[model samples]
Target chain A: MPSVDNNASPPSTKKPLYEASTQFKNWRYSPDHLAHIRSTLNEAAVGVIRKTFEAYEPGSSSNVSFVTADEEHLLVTFYIHKIGQLCGHFRFPEEVEATAASYLKRFYLKNTVMDWHPKNVMLTALFLATKTTNNPISLDAYTSHIPNTIASDVLDLEFLVAQSLRFEFAVWHAHRALWGIWLDIQNLPNTPPDFAKTESAIYDSALTHVRAARLTDAEFIYTPSQIALACISLVAPDLANQWLESKENTPIPESRVDIPPRPSSTAISASLEAIRNMITNSGKVPHVEAVREVDKRLKLCKNPEKVVGTKAYLARKAEAEKKAEEKRNKKVEGQKANDRDPFGQELGEPAAKPGLVDYDDESDDE
Target chain B: MDAVERENSDRQKSWAKEQKVGEGTYAVVYRGREVSTGRRVAIKKIKVGQFKDGLDMSAIREVKYLRELKHQNVIELLDVFSSKTNLNLVLEFLDSDLEMIIKDRSLVFLPADIKSWMAMTFRGLEFCHRNFVLHRGFKMTCQVITPVLRWYRPPELLFGSRFYSSAVDIWSVGCIFAELMLRTPYLAGESDMDQLKTIFRALGTPTEQEWPGHTKLPDYVPVGQFPKTPLRDLFTAASADTLNLLSKCLLYEPRKRLSASEVCGCCSYGSPLYIIPISSPFRYPSHPSKLPKCSTQMAPRPLEEVDGNVDMAGTGPGVKAAAPSKVKLKRKLTSPADESRTRSIARKLDFTKQVNSP
Candidate 1:
């Protein structure tokens, strides 16, 4: 057989590692695609939530005002800030803080605030980010930071958030990319004598822009490097331009391994423009008054099944618990078999012959 | 089931779960085949313990790391789904690991076989390092897929170094490389202190000059000077080129240690090329499939009498590492694999020549 590399078409032969990341392939989108996905998810969520609302009280869904995709976006943005503040409160590193916000943002892209509110999802997203970024904290310690919160509040939503995000934990934040650019910029020839001071100021300001960019649709719409460039351009346009110019005409060695693609200047400029515009326009934290209004409206529009004590929530929980109880009972019954394998009971009946073993994962986990 | 539940169950049903392979502290390993393609897979079902925490950190870390890395040398995580009220991770099925192959007395270790395994490990480590992952995983994670094997912890951890990076993995690569040749763990430390002592004993005690800030580490303990045994002496039969890689990897200073890419020999401009160069004489076969596998059924069973005991120190998360039962295990490579390997090596050499010709 031909080598797998030989089998692969030329498109991905020497692409940089980030290009293969889930953040690049799965999370990235054009502005239109991002809008379309949000609206589609919102529309579906509204329709399903409307049924639940009406089912509880006839014509109640019509009486209740559901949040629009834009409004949901506003709520999610507000929670992203909460994640940032939570990270601050916990004194998490920048990566943890940014990763949590990114997780919350990505979760809502697939899920809706109506089905799983970003308020709860934000906690779990931050918690999961801590783990993925290798700065793990106990659930008790995490929840204790927030008043009236418990371990289950964060724990229950973890799998759901992980599921919603398709278990892609590695998110390449723009700040890291910007840091790379900062390092590379130093390595560039003919730097100003005080380039350190100048670059530090620019980097600090660009870091702010990059953090703001996280709240925008920039991550979904642009690659981290592109976004980093955009942030740098926002801070010191000349520096960003010089960096691009320095990188543009670098000789592609004969081997041509790991060359970051040099897109045409116009194409890169357009992408940078879109990214910068996003960072400037919608990236600020949503006004608290505006977010509060949306949050008040969200109370009426939420999927009652997710609420703790609502009839729908109780009914859903009872059904799930009943199914689980049945599963446990069946497991207990299976445990009665006189013979057993090392791990667990066999799904099939016990073997008649001695020294014969069977394989069944029927009741595996505790 | 709603969309999420339905989707989860559908994923769960896609693989037909078969025999139990190995069980871990937090998960169970089951050998299964994907129903769609009949492709064999190892299903690691992470036990959802009495719901104090939502998921285990090990499970999350394993899934997170595996999902990002996709290499033949690194174990592939095929799928992940929540089923039977627990998380099930579908992994590529590998029947055996280096520990088993090394331990089997009947199996002869060929130079090419050692090179093949070392090369695969280096490639996998390179990928991990490229992704900015510090492959410091030291859990009892079995198989070639786990870049951080339990037996291969670097010395820094013992000396209580917190801020280490890719260099740590290079040290492990060095240890693994050495182990491949010696057929024993190069720095087999029973405990944290013992491990450090073992490492110092083999490769002399580091002075402040050798490793700057040697005394400043949090857990640094004074061990009397032991002259560094020449690596070639310890690895007596090893070629100079192989010993060169070992020294580069086993450097005392973390900063001085060769990176994964350096060991893999990156020639791209501005990349680390401390040791590996384009024209380096020694190179391992790139393809791992052509490498030797433990047939597991040796004609002469040194381990047949021991029931279910292969003395496997650590098992991969899933997959059948050693022959589970007392069934005749492969301690010998079949004659065809032997033939294919030589053919593969020749083909690789020709391919290398073709590339270098330009």
Candidate 2:
């Protein structure tokens, strides 16, 4: 029986929903840890792809260049910008645009551009975002919008990209969180008399900053609410500070001792400032020249098995087909046996007990 | 049942051939056990690349929201993986839902059972509502079969009001609570108009004075005036406290409805529900595990995910909540690290496909 030991934790003083989010749980990392993961993944991919190139041609790897972690990051960033442009072309909402960008960035964290090209992955991620964000566009309509693209180019990598995302698609974007704060700012007690006049302009500017923040590591490092607060501060520092002060002065319920004390206004401001700086420092789109060089290297290093008309591709396809064929034959036999006694159990081993490996073993005999 | 015999039988045959346990429009549910822990799980295998568009909207919504949600009341999405071109969601396989139990003529629902179900469902709803998640409308959806959804819809939605809130879920809970008591749907509307007529007949047609801007709703039209039906007439056995809670949930103004916290009797607001004391027969809403195998089976099919949070229905305890045999998803992924060396003596024969030739 599933344990029911946590009954004491009453419904009162529930943790904010964002804290339980997969974004906070699985995706977060310290800056040092994030850098370490990327470097390690890049190095491992380089070593493995190097061997594959060598196997294809003697000493070919030495002649070719490998993409470094930084170069891969630069190239993925370039694609992230392209996603925004594509969204504009398609007239997709901000949620779709941001989600696609989020998917591409998250995908690269788990994978390298060399294994799967960013171009194909970006298109797949965007197409996926259209569905996930409820902005559905027909595949034909989507393919026609982009140049030199086919349906397969996007559809083929859909599974790979979805897996890389670990199927966590409800991204808490900074822009949405910013909208909440913008609403709260209107009702603040000490709102500037003339604040209403510039509210739209201020929000638009903050939205611009939030868009930039998407290109950086701010999402992994900070909460959406925190990022939004920072964006608000970037556009209207005094207004944000005043709002924080009002919150600090307000007393929390006496019964809720478990809830942490509000951060001092200064501390909140300092953290907000740090977040703004993080976005401002590293959030610019990578230069085209720098990205083009990386893209050139990516084409040469991309998995040969994934590309069309490659020997490795044909070999892998044939092997996969053979495995599928054998499994199908085994399934047919199992069905024939079942036909003899439709109401009875499996003619041989019960599938539940044998596991998939056992099924493979059974197929090996035939 | 006799008229669509062909269509119905065709569905049944296809369902039998397709899956051992369950099948939906976009996915099939297979029963599989995890080899490692021997843990029971339902493998919801979604067919990918089968449509002109890529992954199904329902599959994406399932992963997107369910992955973020982790509550005892909500079904657990154990894991997700892919094999070939299929997306698989590993979910806890439970046997039954509230709908089945309510519909089960053999089982009797005690007043305490009714309270427990009410409290549990409300708590699950409260968790969504407290997060400002407008369930059944936008951020999250409660997808059940049509009867459950239509029966649970609040008046505002029936009136075509686009805006929704915690009050929306409150109305659904009220309907579910009524079903638990009556063992029949409270207002089983045959159509949207009939649904409103049924509601007005039972609870009196709302006027501008009662609902405050009731006539201004997008779908609002001139509705007939009907006196409110007495609670005693509908729920002859329900206690006074039960009546109060039910009435609060069914209030005309969306804001006037009781929040999940209040209904569960855990609120700091001068407890309107204190009369239905926690120490009463409804003992802290017992965990589903404590009961028989009537646990929830969650197979999230795609519904709308955008701004208009239209709901499927009492999306609570009964949608396709059937306990499939335990089965866990196994992935066959292509890792980035696979190196094979084929030491060929020479390139003797060259064969190439000309499929891409133009």
Candidate 3:
């Protein structure tokens, strides 16, 4: 049987990592080097602290401060593992797990853990990921699949995640790229015969490395094809070198081996090192007390009044209510006129308000 | 309104929906125009919460692939925005589809026209396959054909092969090609079992030697031995080049079935549709003055008559039409045509109730 070139074009060609990463990064972090609207410890730290303090001002008390970027990362990383476990239990395709984690990671970058609890947001990401990956389960089955969950918990937060990500749902995972590289490597004339026998093991180990790479910020920094090549290099450097060298004057059609144009060997080494650094950096486990404190502060931040309970909170609530009331009254007034003046336009009335007329007809049902 | 709702509305306002064009099981399709440029688009508003699930799988699959696939032949997913819970998919608004053209009995299909449609279809499929995406429900879709007829479901699907690849779609394209020539479904089998029988009767019963590992399929069943009917006989009017292309696609072994790129390389489809003009001794009647009049009347006969002739092997097209026994038998029992007629009647009844309905 002819070897089908499993490698088509890497998904990164359609959407580069740099462009997609910037959208997510700018949303969470500040554009200026100095400050963020919300900050994390590494790059966006100050912004997160300021936002948390602004949202949850416990009467000038110093007790409920924002969590460090590391703590935030730890909490998110923990739940991402949970997402993987859940996906595993459900027998979801690997793409679902990858997308779910990507969404969760992107969500936390812009939002404080305090803003939206990871419990529901985590599950929502999975649900939405399943849909985006073309393996959607019924909201009922999805909720019931996990213990003590309901449909609303997942559905309600879907919009929030989507909006935060700017509704850019096309996510590229390294698994496919890795598979492509593996296929190209196997077909090479230089591959050892024993390599064919250990093919499954090598594939599994490479996949595990790819999965590990997902936890790092390398996804935002590098293209999927680069990350895939980097992972392959880590697992088997000799094969990776051979695969890279095989590119020159190769008889294989470029379309059949959908590898992105190879970066410089130095660039490849640098990316692999970055991936290694990320893995090493993420190895540190934060203190349990720190994580708990962050969780406590997050609850208060989600419902700020619970901690604030100040006149400022009441004043803000009252103002919102007043604005809503005024809007509702104006809507009713418009609907009454529409009902009374069916031929209002003929009578030379105002060309009905652009958004107002449609709103009334839809909601009022008359 | 909350910020999210406001944002969603802002996105929605960009597209001005003119009117609802059609409805699917899980979507309300609207013919819309972009507010800024007045570009015509099809807005498929996927109905939320139909499945106990959050969103339909078909919607997910469509969006997942459409976002990445860029081709003139394929329907483009221009934009996706949510209006409350419903996700509105702005798509390229195609004026007509191949199925609509084939179904319009009044519109005679020139070999050139059929070739053109096949080239476009195969080109699109080839692009999708090259990108490693599968059009799982190909010919069974409403966009391609009447949704209920599983006639184009490949033998792999019938044998309960969950791991089938792009070849499944290739098989379906073969059926579409045959339909283009026959002017009716090539195998309008009612059930999965019946579908296989129809396929085998038209082609031959697949032996283990012919389709290695076929017996290992989950639902594989041994059927009575049947000899292959020559493609020339079944597609009576097809040219040799067209017949050769059709057989390659309809091969029993999926791997033996032509890939989209390979199909494109065939003698018939190798060049542009009009490069070699097809000269025919028997010219089909030209398109009727108005298509609807002939379609409403002529379509029913060709449909039932095609099936009746297939079943009674010796009877020719003339005999099938003249035989009162076959007509009464067809009417007494439900045929696909009868089922469609019933559906049309139901559709008419629903017209009176369309007022104030979503």
Candidate 4:
């Protein structure tokens, strides 16, 4: 018989509430109002950006970066993290996250991190980005995300962002750039050292960090590529730096020394600085406490070696795998139980009863 | 009954009771009475189903355009209502049509009265023409003659061309003017073709030389071409000034036709032909007892009661009856050949010829 475990954790319930509260205090409002403010602000910002871009560079070529295999996994990780944050913060539909990611990718094609303030641009891009993607959240919903206290002030700021970008909502991301580079690299022999493995690891780690960062308003300050680079550096610093350095084709220039050698470190520092400045300027220490929780998780991944292949890692992995297996078994058993319930008879016997007996014995010995 | 038909029947019955007017093809014009206020009104009930597929096109066009048209002289469409089965059009009730006045042998309009009617006709026509609406169906029947004998129609309308301009109304006005003078229809053709021939005979058949676009008319045909007859030949008895104004209005080419506003300006009551002395013996009897008690609020009563058999009533003198008979004789003596020629001429002036020609 299937184990009736309705008590199992309802995924996403706690996270969204936590996110909503955090977002509310920071914006200083309830969910309903904040959504409207966020939506309005987002719309105004995107409109400004679109107009600015078109005015400055009418028919300008796209500025996309080519990625290396070592960087690919890290970029993917960053995008995953970003998607998580979007899901958590805005409580957006999955489709919105997908659309935002696509916009980030496309934006990167014609724009570099240095071209505009990624912080302002990314938000504008996201705001405008919703239009092309099906199931758009309203401008009111976006503006409502803003804190009630400074809501009026933020309205103008949002308009400025939109005007700066000339209303172009589309964006590009490093994940696609990484993929393109990977495809290109496949044609050549002599793979870079630990490139594939490091990339894959970075991909996993970056995803988690990006998701966490998205909830914190880091997107307002950092470009998608910078976020991606930071996540990669956090997950696999050596590989990310090597990949970046290789593309630069020069020794660490003296001028760029202050800007951390690793992309992930630079990205993290930028995000941290932005958050710290925002907290200090807002004069609200209580809000910082909530942000600290996010900061702690970010720090764990910030120094990846602390978590990599540790007992904690293995334990977490094992537990996750076991839970997944149990879920599959439960589904199968439920189907069988439903079928047998009609006749009041048991169907197939439990497979490998011995495996359970052995596990029990092992638990007893421990 | 089907759902739609039953609803329509219900609407028709209700509107008939409400407006208390007669039914038309597209609408049931009713004499409405506001239940609370007891104010009398006219309501026209339009059926929605009947409007599908250009069937209700004329009504729709009238409503769409007339909704914006606010004029004193023109009939007013007061309000509209709609239901599942019918679209209701409410209009102001007028007393009588011009045909009633024109056919009323007892009512011999003074020249000044005719002039006033002509002036009002032009004013209404001018407003319509300015708004780019052709009163495609202007006729004595459509014209609600006010308490006076006014030339309420134009000539182009009398000659049946639905696609005509304000010139059509001007043409009807010309016909009304002629009717006032002769006490009969100027172009009383039996059919559309006959009407055109009557117009052509009186106005003189237009040639390609005289009317540049004559042959280009939709119904234009190369009949054995006749020479243009001078205006003098048709209205030989008409005053010179009246003839000039009449000739201008009767231009075959629409562009050459006098505008309604121009007619208002040019055709004066002070003109010799229209200046009848007040002492003239042709005056209507003043006694209400001598006349039928007609209701101005209701739609026109039957013609026989109002105009026909006026002599039998013996309310008027014998001289009035003899006057029309003598006028009819004068018309017959003028031309038997012209009448026969006009009939053959009408046969050649088919509307289909115009439609097919261009």
Q: Supply every candidate's count of residue pairs whose N, Cα or C atoms clash at under 3 angstroms.
A: 10, 10, 14, 89
Model 2 chain B poorest ten-residue lDDT run: B349-358
Question: What overall lDDT, based on C-alpha atoms, would model 2 receive against the true structure?
Answer: 0.65
Model 3's C-alpha root-mean-square deviation from the true structure amounts to 11.6
* Candidate 4 CAPRI grade: incorrect
Model 4 Cα lDDT, one tens digit per residue, A1-366: 111112111222212221222112222333344345444433443444344334445542133122222222233224434443644687665445644544453333223222222333445445544433323455566656744423233232232332232223223333433444444333333456665665565566556555444433334344445555555556666555555555556455553322334446465566545543432343122244443443343332221112347554465578768986886687677567657656555547553321111111111221
Of the true interface contacts, the fraction found in model 3 is 0.17
**Model 2 misplacement above 4 A:** A1-13, A261-273, A333-366, B1-19, B137-145, B221-223, B265-358
Candidate 3's docking class is incorrect
Error of 2 at A138 (Å): 2.8
User: How far out, in Å, is residue A270 in model 2?
Assistant: 5.6
Tens-place lDDT digits, model 4, residues B22-78: 543334445565444554445654543532221122333445344544454555555
Query: Residue pairs in steric clash, candidate 1?
Result: B75-B145, B142-B315, B142-B316, B296-B329, B296-B330, B297-B329, B297-B330, B298-B329, B298-B330, B298-B331
Stretches of candidate 1 exceeding 4 Å from the true structure: A1-13, A187-190, A198-200, A257-261, A321-363, B50-53, B137-153, B206-213, B228-236, B270-291, B297-358
- Top-lDDT structure, candidate number: 1
List model 1 lDDT by residue over A60-104, tens digit each. Answer: 888788899999999999889888888888999898999898888
True-vs-predicted CA distance for residue B52, candidate 3, Å: 3.5
- Which has the higher DockQ value, candidate number 1 or candidate number 3? 1
By summed lDDT, which 10 consecutive residues of candidate 1 chain A come out lowest?
Answer: A1-10
Instruction: Using lDDT, rank the candidates from best to worst.
Output: 1, 2, 3, 4
By summed lDDT, the worst window of 10 consecutive residues in model 4 chain A runs over: A354-363
